[model samples]
Target: MGIFEFVANNIYYTVPIPVYVAVLVVLLCQVFRRIFISRRPSIMESTPLAHKTSDLSHYILKSDSCPALQVTPDTTYSWRDKPQEVPREIKPGKYFLTMNIRKLDPNDYIIFDERFLSEYRERQAIIENVGPGKIFVADPSDGGALDLCEETLVVTVDFLVTRYPSMFRKTERGVFCIDAGEEYDLVTRPWSRHPLEITCLLSGEDHILIRCCDDGTLRVAAVGLVYSLNIDWRSFIGKELGSIHKDAHVPFYESALQKSVDRYFQKLPPDKLISRANWLTQVGPELRNDNFPDKYLELVSTLPGNTITPETIVNDLYIRVERQAMRKLPSTNGVVFKFRVYATNIWDLEQEEGIPRRFADHIRGLPEPILRQKHCLECADCILKAMDFMAEQQEKEKFMNSYD
Candidate 1:
């Protein structure tokens, strides 16, 4: 009563006491509701960063659980009706396209989605950038890449003919018909055209064939690597698994993960299929090396130093995710691996509650060997900055929530 009397007497000499008391009551209710009744922002809400934020959020926010490998009965990929444009790096005048693929926690072994249009568009762009010569490098003497190329073509044609005969028919010229104007000679083709057909049909997906050597080691035989990140296809074509993953501490005999990987390959039956995902971040969309068709060595020669700034790392960075699928070819007894690459901005990470903190924690906790293998030393400062910024934001949110 004293408080009310004081307010009524002192608020204003001209104002009515009842009107002032009513306004005071309304103001108090609003403050009380704001502090005690409202809910905080939901962690699962869609972020402004990417259209598929909700889908990607499930993977980013948690350590993926290793699920049982399932067989994908056929190769009829669900195609997106429309293809969306992804960002590419901008060089002063020249344009360079890049796809980011990073190491990921153990997740589901394989994924088959309707990505026909998306894959076709990216494949077209890759072809235009790299051309046929570099995109499909299969020398009969090199053996594996070309052999795998042929096998992949056969499988692709078989799938098309069997599953979607309306879209694929047999031509009188001994060619497989895609449409009235388009026909592919899967049988009589030169070694080169086999890879071409594989690329044409599996537009968005990149292929690499691995075969066991006489010495009981695995080697990368052939790769339809149109969207490679940093590494050249030629360099990896004939390399062993250990040599390929040397930087990541993957030892054939020593590391348990390495041993399990080998065991998985050895035991993977011809009809069984398995897949996994890997993720990484880069400063910009210009990830694929400029060595697509030609000038690989030239591009390597002029490559920039590994120096990067926190500002650039934070502002220019984006996430790169690769969905990898592996299965054994019943005929050749060789394993085919598909790397389907996708990119999303790191800002997507900000959308999930506790994600930024989790990312910061993971990066901070990385061991020296793993850190070096990730090539994260150069971007360490920027990455750390991002982590810290996320932490600060989280702290501010917590403080605000405390009142509620």
Candidate 2:
């Protein structure tokens, strides 16, 4: 029989067609799933802080691993027994006050120093992620904004030259050039390049340049960020600081208080600088993008209980702390909000005397509404697991140390 005729006549030939179709369907399903998952921005993999691994059992835990355990609910736990004040209430206007900010420390102003190897790696990650789009976008209608950009650039470059002399150099033509090994031609504007260079040459901290609008509003004009965590910078470009906080669930942006915040930025003296630190617990220590409510909902909705467990929580979890500073450029009158991200492992918190208890107590004290806003329902199981783990580790260490 001819080959085609034989196959056509054979019943087994029919099986291959159906099997091929089945395989194609399965592949299509997988492709769609992948596309859906990847549509959202991904967390860029970057090197974490130095000393993250220096003492794993201590207060500095660092690892690049995802959650591996399924989250389990612990109903028998009691957090009231410890009673420590932490996770402070989002008291309105607490950090934005006009208290006399001390004479600025150059080190405090610059969070990430390029002298560290890990910070340099992070800078590369940011440059890679902040591609194509101008990191500094000027309000097109504001003709004077370009002047402000140039002025901000000069102020920043001068600050870098004066504060970190070794990291910067001036060309014979007096053009300030960063000492980064490679050029970043993609970062076009001088203001953008200045912060871009700072990000690439330094480590740890991210920079945001907020220029004062003639209308008394402070606009976020530029940013050098690689460790965005959950923030989407594109949305905030050229937006007023008060308008930026408009959607925030917190009461800090109440109309009267927002006016004060705006006033504070406007009247902030060039000689003074202020700083604050905020803390939270995260499931992973990666310093890149973290899909907050949307991605968190997607993951938890599909596989809520299976997404995390105590082991995974403890293994992958981190204490996320943001050290933020606000200062005004003497020349441009522009403001800079510099943020340094510090992630410590839950296991490490056990080393400290009262940090774990205090943090947990604060978490417990948070009102249900705020907790809901923070998406605690999805991550509550894992958070509870971390708290319990920290407590157990704390007691174990204390018991062990008593003999010494």
Q: Indicate the worst ten consecutive residues by lDDT in candidate 1.
A: 89-98
Q: Where does model 2 exceed 4 Å of error?
A: 1-107, 112-115, 129-136, 165-204, 229-232, 293-297, 303-315, 372-377, 381-385, 399-403
Residues 1-404, candidate 1, lDDT per residue (tens digit)?
69788877777765778997899999999998898634643322332233333321232223122122222233343334334333221122221222222333222232324555445556667666767566665534553444455555555544444444444544533344443345553333222244534544443567777886666677777767776664456767677776777743532324434455565676667656555555556545554632221122234446688343345445656666566767776545677777667766666656556666766766676655544444455566667777678778888988999999
Q: Rate the local accuracy (lDDT) of all candidates.
A: 0.53, 0.53
In angstroms, what RMSD does candidate 2 have relative to the true structure?
A: 27.1
Question: Which candidate wins on TM-score?
Answer: 2
Error of 1 at 190 (Å): 2.6
Q: How big is the positional error of residue 123 in model 1, measured in Å on the Cα after superposition?
A: 2.6
* Candidate 2 lDDT, 255-290, residue by residue in tens: 446777777889987767677666555666676647
In order of appearance, the predictions have TM-scores of 0.58, 0.61
List where candidate 1 sits over 4 angstroms from the true fold.
Answer: 1-78, 81-119, 142-145, 157-183, 200-203, 247-260, 287-308, 352-354, 388-404
